[model samples]
Target chain A: MADFATIGQQFVQFYYNTFDVDRKNLAGLYRDNSMLTFESAAVAGTAGIIEKLVSLPFQKVEHRVDTLDAQPSSEAGGILVLVTGALKVDEEQKPMSYTQVFQLNPDGAGSYYIFNDIFKIIYSAA
Target chain B: MADFATIGQQFVQFYYNTFDVDRKNLAGLYRDNSMLTFESAAVAGTAGIIEKLVSLPFQKVEHRVDTLDAQPSSEAGGILVLVTGALKVDEEQKPMSYTQVFQLNPDGAGSYYIFNDIFKIIYSAA
Candidate 1:
């Protein structure tokens, strides 16, 4: 088996970086069967996921990742990455914290694609 | 239905606060049938979960929450809260960020207990 932890860390960094700059480019990281649960909305397929992202209420956003943890799954070449970070939208006074779980499957050549993603915002401290 | 979003946010805050201070006291937040997935380990029941906590390596800890989001679930009186935060254990220089999913069931009188909990530490930014 390959070093899943190493690969998973790299994938996390790449995914978040791309999401901040060129979200459209992220399309390559997903396949036709990808699934995304944005808060309460469940979006399936790469196209539908992209559509939801483009239609988000926030215009400008910044993601500050605080932690990234990855573990191998029972399935071959499958990895689960749990990300906890803060998202800043526009000029909001406080950034919204979020927890996102990503199930990635190897697509060969040390690359992986997101199979499933679930994201939710955390509670405000105030 | 009641305002799920508001109640969920409040629950998230109270849960984390209690976790940091009196972890032992957290037993009240879980019933005998509660479920927990801590890292790769699956623990069932409040007794098992509390045992896992006492066995952790860290002695002193602090949690810094970044974001919190909650939504109502199909289950009656059930709320799902996703938390993103940084955890500082002992004297570690770098805090580990984590994403936790909590399924809370109202126990009446504005009180709630965890039915299911999933937690994972994120990747180290360095």
Candidate 2:
């Protein structure tokens, strides 16, 4: 399993890679059974998740990890990491900021999937 | 230190009490120096956080915990719990559901401050 810090860094990279449609790297960050719930709608399984990840139209996605907090799960050996940070999207080369939250399980030899992936746009009003 | 499950449950309870302006119970959940970062606005210290919490005019605040994921923090003794859940707020008796994320350190002795508290409102369209 990767350490918390290593896993945390990977998450930020994963966010950018996914948003920018970096299909090769995106495949490594998530598991085959990973799922995503956007707001209230559920998108189950990794394939569905990848479908959504590659669909974002942002020209560039930059993620800054402010903090990566982790704890033990109810299951004896499981882990739950909450990644909180700011994201800047380059839409037509214009920078737009946003807040993102990601929960991941980084244990043993596998990095596994994202338990949660949520973001809200934060940008200066035109 | 409270176990992961116990700490996880308190996280949900903390959300309701804090948002409902239940300042009394709120005192127990967070640390004395707990700070809150709202969207992108910085609200420093527990006092500042309370001011923001009590200022909300929702008729009632109800919070729920769907899944509590925990992992080990960088600190040897510190455990970081990332709580992922759904919340229903009774604003004028109209149910409003939203997604909430709370990162906390529930190790021992005292339940420290929230590492992260961010939520987005979700409602059905007319």
Best by TM-score: 1
TM per candidate: 0.56, 0.48
Full-model lDDT for every candidate: 0.73, 0.51
Off by over 4 Å in 1: A108-110, B1-51, B54-126
Candidate closest to the true structure, highest lDDT = 1
Residue B23 error, candidate 2, Å: 3.9
Candidate 2 residue A89 Cα shift, in angstroms, is: 20
Model 1: per-residue Cα lDDT over B32-110, one tens digit each: 8677778757787899999987688888778887766665432356665667777888888677767787767777766
Candidate 2 interface RMSD after superposing interface residues: 10.5
Best by DockQ: 1
> Native contacts recovered, in order, as a fraction for each?
0.06, 0.02
Q: Per-residue lDDT tens digits of candidate 2, residues B1-126?
A: 566546666666665667566644565555654545443344655667667766665555666554444433333333344334444456444443343455565436565556445444432211
lDDT of 2 by residue, A6-96 (tens): 6556666666666555544565656654545443344656777777766766546666555454433323233344444455566544443
Report how closely model 1 matches the true complex, as a DockQ value.
0.10
Tens-place lDDT digits, model 1, residues A35-104: 7778758787888989888788877788987766665532356666677778888788677767787767
Point out where model 2 deviates above 4 Å: A1-100, A103-126, B14-21, B77-93, B106-110, B123-126
